[model samples]
Target: MSVIVGVATLTVVATGFSPHTAERETVHWSYQGSTGPEHWAGLSEDFAACGAGREQSPIDLPEDTAVGTSSDEAITIDYHPVTAKLVNNGHTVQANVSPGSRIIIDGTPYELQQFHFHLPSEHTEDGEHTAMEMHFVHADEAGDLAVVGVLMEKERGDSAFTDLWDRLPTEEGDEAQINEPFDLAEFLPNDRDQYQYDGSLTTPPCTEGLKWIVLDDPVSVTPSQVAAYREVFHRSNRPTQPLNDRVLTLVED
Candidate 1:
């Protein structure tokens, strides 16, 4: 498989806001101090959803609060081996995936756009944070977003990320070419049980109405592997947002 890296034509436009305009207006948000997540909405008018949106992302998943569903509702991921491009996009290290890979949820196919990482995880389980978190971002035909969140714990290293870790970019704006075929499906945990909810983007602009599928089981990674990624980014994560009136459904498989 061949993956291409370029700006996507379709933008994730919110009802009355454009994230592109926010990106252009406020270009200096960070993960700490006055410019952090707390100040995102105040930074720009386009980012009003950051503080105002009721259905925000990275919420804590309390097992007791989630309603269980049958295995028939499980999401179908169609990821395969593909040559991809890796880049350090200042905020996090992201892999721009090739076309064709997608995940079918309730019969709607969301094409894979990219995958990125966050240190010390973002979403917590019963208020417990994992070692790391991986986000596989996708988009439907209408440009609506769906994100698959995988939690990572420190233990034995998983070889599925060997090639990616070996070529980790050390600086902001730096990029590395992944000529080897990387199997994204192999990187995921074998169990596909996930907590499904409707939420907004965790980052700046905080666009809402996104489908969030956070896996229940966590994959293992070595402490050294976690350290390797941390060297590039000390910490890149947004705090958990309020769940509000949203219902979290556990789709068992």
Candidate 2:
């Protein structure tokens, strides 16, 4: 797929006492062609996993799986309302939070670093795809990465981000501050049934040894919300990767 990045915007619009960032943006990569996913591995040595890694991400989750109920396999998010820096990197709308937000599994704590989105989602469920996906990336003190994927589809009511939509960074390289406090839980679906697997970063420099947790229940988001993203990222998601020999463990709640 061919894509064209949008021009940056400088206007900071506000409504109902909430503050949002101005629109500024740039195109980061592509889905096809010389700069597309197919050519990512050759783009740099750091991205070799894009083509050669035995464990890649965005696998088609199998409906049947070994259920895991152990405490070590459970995920607990410890997040608080905080001001977030919303940036439009051309690839996706990324929200960067300050220290304090984290997720604890078993006894290890992984600090929430940042989160980004993918249009129409990159992962599939039984050969099916969600309207979009939100990846909440966290890392331990040792720098090991764990990502939480929340799939989204259209539904009733406005988004938790409805108040911040107009303030989203729309132009490439645009960095905007959301004056309103945002809660991570406000965006997650309540259903916690999920799948877990070891995989690489979905994007280049496709580093391996990362933990992927995908919630089975998708959160509700409208097409208009997705359409806003489509305007910035013509096509932002990487293609679903090969499953290779990896075992996907179902996280039973």
Candidate 3:
């Protein structure tokens, strides 16, 4: 049997049929069961690449990899909460972002589009599971993607996420305000040390060329927050893919 890979950009078109604009790309994707990661390539012509990508994402980091900070290329993100709309596209829980939000990575500005939740966390530490994970997806001026991951663990009491948890849309396609602005800057850790590498998207049609930065510090979130995410995606994470000789860089804050 020969391994086949298909892929397509998530570009959206404003007219006719595509929701994405000429500059924007939208992807058709799915997760779990027969249609899970294993079937992504066969399911769609655009997703064939998912099955044959050289650099995939969500790798389990070895516990004793001398994790620390060094370089100063640290990026700063300044995000404000807005009336985000929740859209369950049969993959993971995703949000349709409002306007007026942007993320700065090492001074390079990227516009915030939408974000989504992943459970049991996607990236792992020494194969250990973090309670939850939130992916704040951003795109640069050229439409390139740079995803900033904030890992979540059990906390003693309420944290900033409680506000988000309370406001998370229950049904797919439901939209709501957080009762306040959602700032992306506040959600980031003080130490900007991260593991940077070239990787593909975790979801179907799992496109490559994304600049992946997995933060070292795991943020705190109430158990309720974890449970809230579980309600939507219980162990919805795709299994950790192979490294394939990719160089994982540990940068300074």
TM-scores for all candidates: the values are 0.90, 0.86, 0.81
RMSD of each: 5.8, 6.9, 6.2
lDDT (Cα, tens digit) per residue for candidate 1, span 170-198: 77667888887778887799999999999
Model 1, residue 196: displacement in angstroms?
0.1
Residue 36, model 3: lDDT of 61
Weakest 10 consecutive residues of candidate 3 by summed lDDT: 11-20
lDDT of candidate 3 over 99-190, digit per residue (tens):
77876766778887777767778898888878878787778877777777778777877577766666666654456654345676666677
Q: Residues 109-176, candidate 2, lDDT per residue (tens digit)?
A: 99887777887788888878888888988878777788899988867687775766777788766888
Stretches of candidate 3 off by over 4 Å are: 1-30, 63-69, 81-83, 105-107
User: Model 2, stretches more than 4 Å misplaced?
Assistant: 5-28, 65-72
Q: CA lDDT of 234 in candidate 3?
A: 58
The 10-residue segment of model 2 with minimum total lDDT is: 10-19
